[model samples]
Target: MPTAELPSATPPSTAVPAVDLRGVAVRYGPAKAPVTALEGVTLTVAEGEFVVLVGPSGCGKTTLLRVVAGFEHPTDGTAEVLGAVPSPGRGTGLVFQQPRLFPWRTVGGNLAFALARQGLARTERPARIMELLTLVGLPGFERRRTWELSGGQQQRVAIARALAGTPRLLLLDEPFAALDAITRERLQEELRTLADVTGTTVVFVTHSAEEAVLLGSRVLVMAAEPGRVAAELPIGLERGPHTEVAALRATPEFARLRGELNLALTSAAAGTGEEGQLPPAS
Candidate 1:
């Protein structure tokens, strides 16, 4: 038995889900020519838990994230957040792979934009923005323009903006997929701290198995094209530096787990990795 120490599941005390998906499916265009982005999917994210979904391109990972973020409606089945259907700006925050900040806005202004939606008082926006920047280790970066910052820094600002609303649910769609190794690790550490501090529920999508293993309390591996959950890996690693990339990569167990997931992902991609046989890619 692997001895990794992950966050515990909800104890017997409470049972309400922060987010729930039951037999959800999506299709575009006419029913006969429907493209299944997700099919018969079901999952639950408990309050303050972090769940990561890993899959290759065209696996409907983004579509799933959007469903939770309230950006996309499911064609069938139920998807709810906090016991209600989520809508745009409904206590959910989103961070994408790109910063997507307004070119005209400064870093502070971008975050202020999120706060403004909640009708925060004018006098409080700056303070809130500053606090967020500091949280992402971008202190004193309030005056920096979007184009002026490096790619990694821009992502930090994007995350800060998403967090501006003090959202109960935060959805990250490959937000750090583009960053280099060092930057990725730094941001990952900061995110762990942020999650611990705020008790925010997070559902993030990624292509890397190692990332999912390191940051997530539970990992859901989705199959490509008409994405569906193929395998779920619970992360039992202790928090802090051990959660760091080097520490994780240094372990033989890590390598073995990564190999398992790689095989799982490879199978997921070809839609035939089940039954102990690898399928040819489509």
Candidate 2:
């Protein structure tokens, strides 16, 4: 059976720069009845920092991501990627829970599509595409159709597609949520290694505290349904195998943080019936 993992409520932080959002606000519909997703949400993530956003499902975490990706405009405040207002096709890469691959295109071709949109030179594009595949551990799977790969492999392709732009910041919204436990854990490890190797700034959204602790340098606890950063939690740990989930989880610090986050979720659920009504899924 499936179970929910818990997290501590309080989080500590350090200053830096992968992404910074100052007073960002999102309202759907009218001004009076507008649904506010995020407000006065100021955060700074340094280069190469792996920050995870954890919260109740409706907290607008995805909306926050859409805003940062320049897919949705913030009704108030600003979202800056590398010191500039983020624009679509800008130096910001996005990975969603679904692979969203183009069925008509081969894996390599899908990547090429992204690079082509950026106007990369023809001569340089192929090699770059190959490198991206290899980086995501999909080497030589290039000519394969998107549907040919397994769920995990398809997500790898998506990551490659996201990196096709060599983005300054990578935004991922529960990309591994839909996978099986084993597969999800494997991808978590793969992403950690990739983060170390590429020094890419990663902003990830996840519901699993274990996943967040395993992959994040810092975890920002959020409340969904008009999502907002309610609290922050720092893993204060290093990256490594989970050989013992029960054992590591037994530590006082880990348990404490987990409980705190769980409480935040409880609070988020209290007022979320309103926010969840806006979209099919908030």
Candidate 3:
């Protein structure tokens, strides 16, 4: 079977964006002394596009993801996912830094729980569970306890669980941040493949420039203090089954892109009241 193609950088003119935010802003605390998490943030994510938000800590990366997930309402502007206003547990799948799996349930059972919540029939759940497990490279792990798996394996299960609901969009908040270098790289490849195969639009938040460059079709760099978009860079690297990741990373173009992003991020951090702080690698 032919591998699925990545979505084009240019979406069709009439296509409705998977996510649209217009002059969005979020504030916390009382009206007397409020904290601004985001300000004048306007963004649109095309269908099947994998967009990464990268910035230093407290840049409102997580806040932006929460707004899109409908967990938090923006104090200022509009936030929309799949055309209408987004709501929790609707058309969106979320993966956090931790696996957040049910230790009481087996790997398969955890996925089955999500599928069941989606209203799948009991008789059809097993096959779908197996398919999801396989998709995350955890086939036949249905009976295995969540605690028995390695950290990376547990995270794979988490990703599978997120996919169980068949979400149109996936919101990941540094899901691979805690893993070791090798494990993180492997998961990154798997996630890229999974997104291509499912054509799931993804909005991932991370502090790692390498992660952003590798996973995102477009990288949006945000700045601190009332976080806002500072730069947008489209990855023009070739992506296909034949492309070797190591070779791609070794290329001068990859280094150039990474440097460009690092500079943009550094520049955004400058004069933002949090100067001299470097971006996190994980």
- Give per-model TM-scores: 0.89, 0.83, 0.91
Assess the local accuracy of residue 80 in candidate 2 as a C-alpha lDDT between 0 and 100: 80
lDDT of 2 by residue, 106-185 (tens): 99899999999878988888899889999988899989998889999999999999988888789999999899877876
How accurate locally, in lDDT, is each candidate?
0.80, 0.75, 0.85
Ranking by lDDT: 3, 1, 2
- Tens-digit lDDT track of model 1 for 1-282: 332121222222266888888888888889789889998777778898888989888888998888887889999999999789979778888899988999899888888888898899989998998899888899999898899998889998888888888899999988898999888988888887788788998989999988887788877778856777766666667676335667777887677667767776877777774522222222
Per-model C-alpha RMSD:
4.5, 6.9, 6.1
Give the backbone clash total of model 2. Answer: 21
Off by over 4 Å in 1: 1-14, 241-243, 273-282
Question: What is the lDDT, from 0 to 100, of the residue 71 in candidate 1?
Answer: 82
Cα lDDT of model 3 by residue, 201-264, tens digit: 9999999998898888888888888687766777777789546567679988788778877876
Arrange candidates by TM-score, descending. 3, 1, 2
Model 1 misses residue 143 by how many Å?
1.4
> What is the alpha-carbon lDDT of model 3 when measured against the actual structure?
0.85
Top-lDDT candidate index: 3
